[model samples]
Target: MNQSQQPDAADPKRRDILRWTVGLSAGLVLAPLAGCDGGSDDSFSATVDTLPEAPRIVAKNGLIDIDLEAAYAHNSVQLAASAQNAYPGESTQQATDLRSYNGAMLAPTLQLNAGDTLRVLLHNKLPGNDTKYSSLPYLNYQNSTNLHFHGLHVNPGIIRPGVYGDYVVDTPDAGVVPGASRQHEIHLPADHTNGVYWYHPHLHGSTTTQVANGMFGAILVNTPRNDFDLPDDVRDRVIFVHRLNLSDGGRSDNLYDYVNNKNSAFMLNGVYQPTIVMRPGEIQNWHFLNSDVFYPFNPVLDEHTLWQYARDGNSFDRVFRPVNAATSVQMDGRHWPGNVLYPGNRSSVLVQASQTPGTYYLRAAKAPSSTGEEIVARIVVEGRPVEAALPSPHRLPLYNAHQPITDAELAQHGGKTRAVILAMLNKDSDLLVQPIPAGEEWFIPPGDGVSLTDTVFATGNVGTKLAPFQSDLAVTQTIALNAVEEWTLYNLNGYPHPFHIHVNDCYVVKVNGEDIEPYWADTIPLAPNGTSDQPTSITFRSRFTDFTGKFVWHCHALDHEDLGMMELVEVRT
Candidate 1:
């Protein structure tokens, strides 16, 4: 039966049993009973809702001008009355409300050429006042909002002198306040890569809450890199995988409640287990984005092989065939055998439909520890098989290519090398935890433990202000425009974290002191620090070229980023 019908078929006695047996004051009674670990184990029933196809918006004449807005709208997904009541204030009433681009549940896909100009007049129609439950002590900017052109090598914004305030192009200028409008101009360079990119709310402090409310969309930059392409009749799909916590009614102010309550649903295009139809042996290009704030999705087609062609919006010269390796040096340390899209990661893969032509499942083999083996999409293969041969991997053009930093270039432009440590800040912690030194301008939100701090630099009077950090001890690494520098990132936490940098991409040179094939990437995975024996570290070289201003590098885990695991870097002229 379809998802909408399953709820009606549910035994009414189940609700009565839950309501009477489990008291309302206890927060979430169903989450635990429902196995709220965010996994697809049999204990948790699969969602039966039909998947909705995401809408697309293609550019014309190398230009895309649109009116984007962040406002409240209704989602069709139905939640139990008890689930809705778990939320505190207006959030309970706005359980169906979502903050979207152009009022779409899953914002429209923007298609453009490499050199296209994107002009968006963003109108922030969010409520002027914070949610009625805003009295809580924490940073919440529900009423204020901005936009970020993720993965595009465009100017974030220009910052002027005293005449103008700190105007960051990537982030909004004081945000598009309630009923206010702001214009964002982005010019994609002629040499920009042809691949998949995305956009979302980027205002700090409230990014987690706003994004959790579903304020994001996709951007596809088309370029003529490969003359040979998928059959004209082949269907191309963009899958935005995101998570929504239903317990707190999907409210920005109650995100903490959602996190603490562990009430969430994994969805594709805002629906559960939608069926995608394909023909036997048909090769289709699938662009996937992990829009979830903290979940890392390891997608696996039940019996099919996913040939990956791009990573983080940059196309590689050849398709990557998953292989088993004993050590990290054999293949890229970031990706597993199959293409795994970590949080904030994007990938384009070519899926060859099974020749047998039957129903199969697209499952997330590795998700957040709490969630296991969850089904993301259902593949229904039928119809006659398509006769086509897979394209030669080597013949694919390198849509985005970056020359490795030669020894000579490194020697000439190399600046100060820095070592940063990612750690926890709990007082009872002995896991390489570091406490914030005295007299730093940064304040740790109550109960925050995750932090990114520099080990070599001291508090205050260091680095450029453009790349400043919240705490005096969290030093900003300064780099001259066009400078080349090596950064060594150490992970002291118990779990793995994906590190991502803005503005410029980097080349991975070594991992755990072992050299590997260098490749261009904006994000890299760092292994966890396990039991005293295995210490984790990653070293990469980056060139600060082209557009220069203030940008940030942080853990892609949105929750960690919101907590404090982020640092600013300056590319000064």
Candidate 2:
């Protein structure tokens, strides 16, 4: 099975994935609205002592109304003090007389037991803007946006984009686009399976900007399968990781450029401070997400050990495979035994309470940039079991390999393992600039081995005048793994794009032909340069089972997806 060939960005496997995604989703359109313009970035005191009060809820006509002005602030997490940046989605503006540190709107943590009618009413009072004054990214709106329920089976009719429902709230037509004046409604069945799900803005073009500005939250689909009885020290806690750009100026100073293409700081769950304290007898579920505007966060726990529970939205059984070394794995769509949580396209880690109480860090795992901070969250396990002591420093044998499923493992699921690969591509021309608008397409040089449409590469040029444009394709590989199928991923680009898949969890089996450890994950950060010390390809394999739905595969970097490195996949019977 010598399937190895020189990495070509124009492979058939990549094209099929892109075609399927476009066919499944409609184009996004911006709705017209006039409201708040922008704001300044004046610095204020940290408010870790005072957590922003929960949002005031008002139910009107099957809609849950929320005050956009209300948000949460961590007084303890300081800029350059407790952390490098403020929280990822926290807001800085205040509409009331009470002044404190800038805060963030609490993205609702939908704790549903399935079969629940979920009505969300988001009021548009808070305006959208980069710290720096620049043209608005995505839909050019006057500070208004909506929500997109990732990985959940909800009707689009009720999930309108832009302003709160004005019409009878109808599912958008296939051609309808997300606008500034949109609203959305979602309903989930009780049997939807327990896992980690997430929500954010899906309004094309600006999804990256809106999400970067602060529009994301976690959704926990609880089920009875969460029955792992471990040591009391490993309680599950939900941790959210997001990045923000801030400048050295004052309040609403447009300090850091996020949407308009500048880079800045990263935060966890909207805060950075002392280690999160929790009882030793509880399970900590870290609901992680990489909401970085242009970067993928590789979280690593420096002084901690995490017993990963789930990935994407699926669960796994114990003792499914063996590991050998320390390998960096993408947390695309892997799961633990009970589907505790889904990290979305982002990665998450479930740290079982170790019997020994100590301090630990949840940092980015082998990230590429030195300019960004690696420590996203810190953990302090307080209660230790009487008989337990610190175990020797031993890594899980989950590196340099793809997750393997034996007959014993599949037997638990009645012979079902469903898998689907998603393809993402940067599909527009005019790099370093905007597209030529609708009905206009960029022409690529023929026989130049360059892709002009349906992809988002840096530029279509392959380092040659004949290849003057970088590959605009965002993603390029998608495959479906049956119970006995093996999946392989090839990095066909000059730059590193974080590859993520939804539905089932997989392990990296090999990187550039060398067998690594068999660790599990849902998002894999393919390194850039595609040169030595780094392989040009990574192969992964997994037995997909226990779930079915329309999920997406994309670069963990939100900006890449918004620019086009994103696509959807459906697991079916």
Winning candidate number (lDDT): 1
Top model number, TM-score: 1
For each of the candidates, give the backbone clash count.
Answer: 9, 131
Q: lDDT for model 2, please.
A: 0.39
Q: TM-score for all predictions?
A: 0.77, 0.54
Which runs in model 2 stand beyond 4 Å of their true positions? Answer: 1-77, 81-103, 126-144, 153-183, 189-191, 223-235, 249-256, 259-265, 278-283, 319-362, 369-490, 500-524, 531-554, 566-573
lDDT of 1: 0.59
Give candidate 2's TM-score: 0.54
lDDT of each: 0.59, 0.39
Q: How well is each residue in 1-573 modelled by candidate 2, as lDDT tens digits? A: 111121111122422321211110111111111111122411111111121211111111222323222122333234332234322323343121110112544454444444554455444444343322322222232133345566554443323344322122121121123222333445554355455666665543445545655567655554211223223333234455554554333121221133332343455555543345433433444545555555545555543455444455444434322111133343222211121111235333454444556666555543343344445555555533334332222322222123465446546545433222222334343232354333322222233232333443232212211111112332223333344334554454544566665444566656555666445566665534453223355556555544444445565555455444554454455
What RMSD, rounded to one decimal, does every model reach? 12.4, 15.4
Per residue, candidate 1 scores C-alpha lDDT tens digits across 1-573 of 211111211123343322212212211111111211214443222333244544444455556667788888766653222211111201123346666776778676665666677777678887764444323223345557777777777775443322111223232225666898777767778777777778877665567777877888887776212223555544466788877765445454434544554545466777655667666787777788888887766777777777777778766656565411222123244432125566778877778888896778777664323265556667777665677777777765564336676667778896556666665434333332144344432333344322332322111221222111344445565789888888777765655577888767777777766776666677776755522345477778887878767767777776666555677777789
